[model samples]
Target chain A: MSLDFLAGFTIFMLALIMVVSMVPGLLAGLESSGIDYDAVAYRTGVILVEDPGWPVYPPWEMNDEVHKDEIERIGLAVSKDTPNILLSTKVETFFNDSFFTPDDYRNLAIFGDIPYSYHFSLRSLDGVTYNEETGDPLPPGYGYIRRVVKIKEPGVAVINGTTFAPQYTSLSSNQEFIVRLDFGQLLDPSVGAAYRIDPRTEPVNVTITNFGAYLNMTEPSTNATLRTVTFWKKDPTRPIPQFTRIPFAYGTTDSSLYTLTIDGNPYDLTPDTKVFDNDNISLVLKPAATSLFTLDQNSILDIRFNFGDTPSQTNITGIHHYDYNSTNVTLPDLQTGVLEVAVW
Target chain B: MVNDAGQLYTMEGVAAGVIMLLTVYIVISTTSIYTPGDTHIPDMQLEQLGSDVLAMMDTPDTNGTKSALETFVNADDDAGFESMFLSYCNAKASGAADDLHMSANVTYRDGNLIKEHQFLAPDNTWTGRESAVRVTRWVQLDSQPGRTTYAGARAQAVLVEVLLWRA
Candidate 1:
């Protein structure tokens, strides 16, 4: 009886010791946490490529530091209808790491319990610009995705005085030159958002070159005194259809709103200065100021160049239609690029 | 005294042995649930790569031109589509190409019926047991006269599905 008890006890003790030693193995298998990295990367890639993100009205790209929380997602696509077509504005804003921290990217772009390291890179096929955001050097194993995409650039209206000088120049004392943007015509539904020239989202550029040709040869002075550049809006739906001056902080030279360059010198849009012959008058109306005007789809916004000199030193008059006419606005061809996302 | 001691020691040993065996069984069953053994990781990666390649092929290099995918689908050029897709899928940033195979089909709605046109048949390497992933893209094509696959006189959206697998 004593011998049988000893054998049974010894067997139980050996089995217990073996089970205790295998506990670490069981924990090792339980902690094999490498299965979900690729799935998370694929999800992140889909979010960035196919979706246009939330808060579409104000645009996620326009959110500043204070309004960063308002951006629910970060997507590179121009709109939902168009996939793999990125907007230059959104691309610029997304890659600006200084504005967004790693936590913001993890929460907004890549949502997961574990904080995964990421690397994103984009380069134009034509070799224009190469952008990269990286957490660390990539390890041997990682989840990666590469997508080819097209970027739609904003259009520019380049008006040369030599081309339109005779057509625009008039004997009228009002030397005001107007660049009219008919929002109804521009935001037409027939034109897809991918190809639309939306002044609400993109900058409106109107450049007047060869100032000599538009100058008043009859005046003794070869220079024109530009009094002020003002913005005007008109609502056709209103009972009275007439142009009304838009109230703005005209005295402030805010580059964020609009930029005026007379002969390559940056100045306020309302600069009262003398512009010489052969000088170029370039005006860029940024999207920030356009949003403030509170204009609707059918509204007409006019950028008027007022030359207030005695006897009118410049003969730049008449309303120039900023339309899709190849002569008026030069729209660049869409550029192709490749974007890669890697997660580890 | 001998009978009492003998029986108690035997019962205690049996109870302890049974408890150790139960703990091992529970630990193994719980641990197996946490480790899924990497079955889905490769599938996810392959699916993403295939989808991305197809999407990129459909995007035109420049505005106002036909994309490579559109051109291939319009002309019913399976060879062109297959070669282009494989090249894109195999391309790497390090300039080395990977080994991947693909087969594709285009699904479109025809009247009240759905029709599928085989775009590319799998090659010799394809077997019945290989783990394959399916990826799809929407291709908008203008109506082509006398084309049975498209089956419409107006512009239509067709889903291009590709099955990708690695050897």
Candidate 2:
């Protein structure tokens, strides 16, 4: 009965007179401010944001096999199991066109000296080299032959030990050469960058003072012959991969069997996952993580993740930044469903 | 007795205030239409900007390497990093003559980069809570004749740094 909605109030009347008349100008002003009003509002409107801190790399770095803070060694060691004089081929034996990197080509064009010429030669050519005793055809003038071998045990590595290079005779090429590089050695102590070898105290610090070379195969007889390529790790610091963290997540139902992989091995978590204790649950890694995966620098411990009513799979993400610094393992964030993982 | 001019002045003041109040109300109402979905930039500007700069960096497609840096920035709010690291290499493909102004640095916390600092440079410095990395980015410049250019003078020996750990 009071005149609130119908006749309206005194303030309403005042606004009608002022606001109705000023509407066009207000609209025009609003149209001119070109600001991201939404962003401003959401930013200004928010009360608080939540950030949960999680230790990122514990599971991956927990391996006793890890070799850290010091250099480790890798390569075919000059010991009992180290390969010796395996077969190798010339990778650089070519025809008329030889394209080199700016620095390499520049040195040759200016000084005509190839002290740094990228080439390799045969250390053991018995198979391809025509041994007069066997009366086999001599290695074709401009070609190569190669072979591959695996280490029976872990030790220090050198190229002269396990690898062998096939012989080749120079053909129409202007120059033919082979440059020996210790491609097998993974670490050098002088520079102290760090190298490692696993299966021998996890990883022994070492460096690559020498790297295997690109053997020249340009022979005088074979201008275009069949090519055999066998490439490998130049003296590489080797380590046996070890386990790091065992990531496991579970559901509280009868269907709660989850699978988590640590290193390359798998453990049944039915015992480890289901605990009736009301206290805080901590996952303990077994066998202690070590830097066992040093043999192949690119090698890593594969972790398979499976959890919940659905298929739970997680892959280790790389925790590295520019300047080539990498954590070597990626720890997962449980709240975000990312797990801590490592590569041996 | 109030003079006529004084009365007029008072009226003008009242009118100005009322006008301002009305304008503010209208502005708030108009902007409220945008506060939710946030769909305003022209199609794919963010994506285009991001990919364009990433391509210029010549970062690899693999999970890490330069791609990691790009991915890390993607986690930031769209506008949060727009003027900072996002514009670092916006025009890298446009042969050397383009002028681009950008700087990059690491963000640190507790005396360490929030993310580990990995890219290499000649000189690095850190003092207590604050540090700046010199990320060498591109800047347009006056050209010089007969001089061989490496990555062109468009790039200057500048710096890229960030703040992270505070001890």
Best by DockQ: 1
lDDT, model 1: 0.81
lDDT of 1 by residue, A113-194 (tens): 8888987777665445545454556886677767666688889998888799998998774898999999999988877777
For model 2, the interface Cα RMSD in angstroms equals: 20.9
For residues B18-125, write the lDDT of model 2, one tens digit per residue.
665777687768776754333332112233333333333323222223333343432322244433233342222112312223323433232232332333222233
Off by over 4 Å in 2: A1-344, B1-52, B61-136, B139-167
Q: Report per-candidate TM-score of chain A alone.
A: 0.88, 0.16
Residue pairs in clash, model 1: none
Worst 10 residues of 2 chain B by lDDT: B89-98
- What are the RMSDs of all candidates, in order? 5.4, 28.0
Each candidate's DockQ? 0.30, 0.04
lDDT tens digits, residue span B38-60, model 1: 66677867876787678778766
